[model samples]
Target chain A: MPVQLFGPVQVSDTVEIPERSGTAFTLEQGDTLIVIDPRGEQVADLLAFNAEDVAEIISSGRTFDYAETIYLTTGHELYSNRSRPMLGIIEDTVGRHDFLLTPCSYDTFHHFYPKLQPHRGCFGNLAAALEPYGIAPDMVPTAFNCFMNVPVDGATGKLRVLPPISKAGDHIAFRAHMDLIIGLTACSAPDSNGGTFKPIHYRIERG
Target chain B: MPVQLFGPVQVSDTVEIPERSGTAFTLEQGDTLIVIDPRGEQVADLLAFNAEDVAEIISSGRTFDYAETIYLTTGHELYSNRSRPMLGIIEDTVGRHDFLLTPCSYDTFHHFYPKLQPHRGCFGNLAAALEPYGIAPDMVPTAFNCFMNVPVDGATGKLRVLPPISKAGDHIAFRAHMDLIIGLTACSAPDSNGGTFKPIHYRIERG
Candidate 1:
């Protein structure tokens, strides 16, 4: 597919390689890219490399690495053990994004909180987005949360699901590994953690 | 009225007063109450006085002392002054809340954000909620955004509309001043802001 712009951006902003939420697609050489979480409360998982260099991101190319961290935030540098800044968080409005915590999914919910029944209710965000890709529900790992909140308890020193830090129009932009493939899943769990789910607009463009 | 508990607290939590969202009522003396923004992405305005200690809360019943300041982040303390913790930013999912944006109503569409007319819309959130109680459309003021994002420009130091900082179920709770009376409204607008409006639930209880 033509490298397209996905999320919303300013009127004059250039178009960049675009990808849907929770769906990963590779970028081409010489491709400029951006991902705007138009709604400040949204989050995104991004990775990049030279495409020719395996040392850049990874060979397996999983969408998310882990949740010990989540959304890209200022000070968090995207790099390899090589200690090079692949992409440093450029902008953040909601403070430190939830980099740790899995994206919300139905199968996971059935196993974790709100343990729902078989095939009923609103399909969790990631699961629904992955349906077209045929990604098995069983393969769902702990994807890092982008805008999702996961707080650390002072007394327990354990992580807990906190509220999202971004809102309807906040965004994070960065350079890319050989054209990076982007995947996202707009959350549908409208009533999960305290029923604060509010849908936001998405836009990806070239800066 | 008796006090009630709103959250999914311990199962044993009891209440003489029933707590529910989208209702209207007045506060009485000696009533310590909690007001929760179930959907963290809202700004609620509080107008209150000394239900009991008016002389103290209102600067010794000064000529004027309307509740002011923004609210957000769970565990934040809301004080009458810079000291006393009158209301704890208890149970906040989003970090900060706005205190100046007002709720939209059915009539609000016709008045503001009028480009997309011809479609169904409400005037204002609080106005609709207070219609049964004689609160009119013109009386609304800026609300405190619990999870909505409003950023002060780093360069100009001007307040600009940012994306939402909240998701579906994140919430923030505050204490009532007197027998508090409030009007509430949720989202319906699709063209305004980043358009992440979702349904939300509210709760009230006695502390």
Candidate 2:
């Protein structure tokens, strides 16, 4: 599917992360990264690091602490491990997102099937995407689970993976606070829309 | 690190899923599936289906209901969607394993880094592993997250990813109650043992 570009912003960089794959690019300060849930049923795992120091990467704990909410929506700022603002959700078509859920990995699939090996998980995808930038897998930290529906069971405090409540072409855009290296993984969890993981479309625009 | 094979169980099959990869296999009734966490840090996502009917596959929700606990240990029988016993854990070197979490996917990685395409996720791994048996991606379902440490906060009900408490060479073995097709994805999350995703060792034996 073609990548969709949002209006009014001067487009500088545009990339499309196909189903079960990843892409990497640099986002300058004030640049806007637009992530599209093309099919509206897919969830996108987002990870990022400051161009100056990777150690000060995205931290879900900090983001949640700063936002004072378990879920993220428009006007919320994503914080790095250093409690620094990295990206701000200036626009959000879908109101629900998961800041509480960690990224999925091979361990996740291996739980259901013992014979299989660790395949492409978000960790691997992020590692591969950041390899060129000298980023290590261990440096890849927590994420903002965009469009992922993880409702917390009030009684037992359990997390349920439900289908996205977003519509086709719905998206969330983040404004970069600094020069950043960003990665994207189209979630491949079966719970992600019952295994028919649709692709995600994204574009970076000059603000 | 080297791959370790357990005692004289007469291994009939052996497979290794490299970091960010997956494997698939089958076992007859009474056979055994051994999953080894060579580094004791990686998690394995497990998925299975009755050989006679793929629709009757392992279900995390059902397994949790039957096990009556979120963590998996020896003697816990994994249940299918129909709440039928599938794999019975005969032995466990590590007492703690998580069944509360779901597998990792591309959408997961893409959420943080926008440029990344979907790379390896358990769903892709399971599909690739089950392809020989004609299992499609959409058919790949939720998993039993083995060796994963997802501790939930009691007050806020948030999930936290932590390093596994398992030691090197730790393993978990399950005995098949019926003919079954299984898939596995090695846990590849950075939060999984600080990102040095060591390889996993596995073998099937005649019981």
| Candidates' RMSD to native | 21.4, 14.4
For candidate 1, the lDDT comes to 0.39
TM-score of chain B of each: 0.57, 0.88
lDDT of 2 by residue, B55-118 (tens): 6777654555345355667888987654579999999988777664445555444553356455
Query: Which docking band does candidate 1 fall into?
Result: incorrect
| Highest-scoring model, lDDT | 2
**Chain A TM-score for each of the predictions:** 0.57, 0.90
lDDT of each: 0.39, 0.72
The reply for model 2, stretches above 4 Å from the true place, is A1-8, A113-118, B1-207
Deviation (Å) of A175 in candidate 2 = 0.8
TM-score of 1: 0.35
Candidate 1 runs further than 4 Å off? A1-21, A28-72, A80-86, A113-142, A190-196, B1-207
Lowest lDDT sum, 10 consecutive residues, model 1 chain B, at: B58-67
- Local lDDT at B92 for model 1: 55
Error of 2 at B122 (Å): 36
